[model samples]
Target: MFSERFIQYIKYEKRYSAHTVTAYQSDLDQFMLFLNNPGNADPAPEPEITHPSQISYHHIRNWMVELIDQKMLARSVNRKMATLRKYFKFLLQEGVIETNPASRIQSQKIPKSLPVVVEGDRLTEMLDSDEIFSADFEGRRDKLIIEMLFGTGMRLAELLGVKEQDVNLHDGVVKVLGKRNKERIIPVNTELKNLLKEYIDLKKNQNFDNNSFTLIVTNKGAGAYPAMIYLIVQKYLSNISTQSKRSPHVLRHTFATTLLNKGADLNSIKELLGHANLSATQIYTHNSVERLKSIYKLAHPKA
Candidate 1:
């Protein structure tokens, strides 16, 4: 149906990250489920909405309330709402619907939350400790995972998409396909560059066929998956950080926060992180400010 067409539109034409596309599709499915009656219908006599024309602002608002009532976080609710927004827009353009009913709906208000960052020194110590990572391929590979995420502000998807051909060790830059399939060149620091070289040599010597396409791989010489990378990052981060969140995203936050704290401009960090706009990168500024506030509160003398 049109749902398949809508999904393919986002996946190919929009070039959204696979994970994001999956989430959007799932959200759309949930919305359709909400439309279906009797089996899993709403308390009201909501008809099985088979067409985009049947969806109205009232349905979307009710769905939002239902999601909130189900204890879905505001951010999650907002994202689902975003799915409706995009879906309706596409339907309007495709002539499946005349008006975008999902338009003009305000998003749920969310509290401002700063990105979580680990201290630079703590990360340095963790990466340097011989006790932390082993000398073997998996160990080094895992370590490089942490290093690359923290050293560069790349998202997990971007890191997983790196290919051997994309690396230019001599030039000290690596190409990454960022959100929406946008290509951007990120500079590799000397430390990360050296680590990359070592990792590549190890992979080649080990003769892993997976290294033919992707840079990071599983122990069985296959391309890595999201859960694997998440587990690897979570496993190593647990050693150094006690934060509730220790996923690859935390390291990305650390990377951006580190750059902002180090006086790097927002535009530079935006370029490095492959953000489409500066506002996304500007959150690091808030992170930096909050960090400074914490320091002042800890270090200030008698008031």
Candidate 2:
């Protein structure tokens, strides 16, 4: 009952995306299952927890241990822990629990890995090479998808959520709805603006259902979903990049890294990428520093 109310609170009041809400729901369900069937998994089991109010730090620790024993990565386990922390905070706020069980729990320290980005010259070569992306409707749509990610540095979800009205060809700006439902306007390059206009015209000529107002659509005229977008990005990126991580996010990283390497201000890149904080955008600087080191090594004559 409490879980249902929390789900509703996040979905309606917090306005979290469906994907995020689903993740929270899954975390809660798993935790509840652990509480209710603690000893069922073994010949001798522990006592079952009957209510949220009865949960303590010990139970939370046992759950974390079980997750780690199952070989879940530290990053994933930390996300689940965050879900529990949020849930307990909600219970505390509603006066159903006197104390938060997850308050004292510490998240596992995760290694900092720099984002994988395709080299700028390689990406430009692939995009500019003739016949790489065909001229048909599907081809045009696919090309636009790649360009949109690399050009605007928008999240895949934000790109998929774009509606026809969100784009302003005349003004050369695209309105992106970002995390926590924050909206930001990102400028579109002249080349990409023309490509968007062409894609829009092609979409209109398809006579898609009137209810489908999304800017990017599947071949069947339905709005593009996450899986389809992933596959599209993966397929195109494989053509030019040998990196193991070649998803839409890599393109976003490429966009930001390219700008940073070319001397764009960090704050400007933050706004363009719709990052809520400057620190979130600072990771790209690591890429810039690496590039500088490479240039220095190649040019310096000292032994």
Q: Please, what is the TM-score per model?
A: 0.94, 0.95
If candidate 2 were superposed on the true structure by all CA atoms, what would the RMSD be? 1.6
lDDT of model 2 at residue 27? 96
Per-residue lDDT of 165 in model 2: 98
Cα misplacement distance, residue 186 of candidate 2 (Å): 0.5
In model 1, the runs with Cα more than 4 Å from the true position are 39-46, 209-211
- Screening candidate 2 with a backbone cut-off below 3 angstroms (N, C-alpha, C), the clashing residue pairs are 39-45
Cα deviation of 252 in candidate 1 (Å)?
Answer: 0.8
Per-residue C-alpha lDDT of model 2 across residues 170-279, encoded as one tens digit per residue: 99999989888889999999989999999999888888775588988999899899999999989988888777888899999999999998889999999999888999
Candidate 1: RMSD to truth: 1.8
Worst ten in a row by lDDT for model 1: 37-46
Error of 1 at 237 (Å): 1.1
lDDT, each prediction: 0.87, 0.90
- Where does model 2 exceed 4 Å of error? 38-44
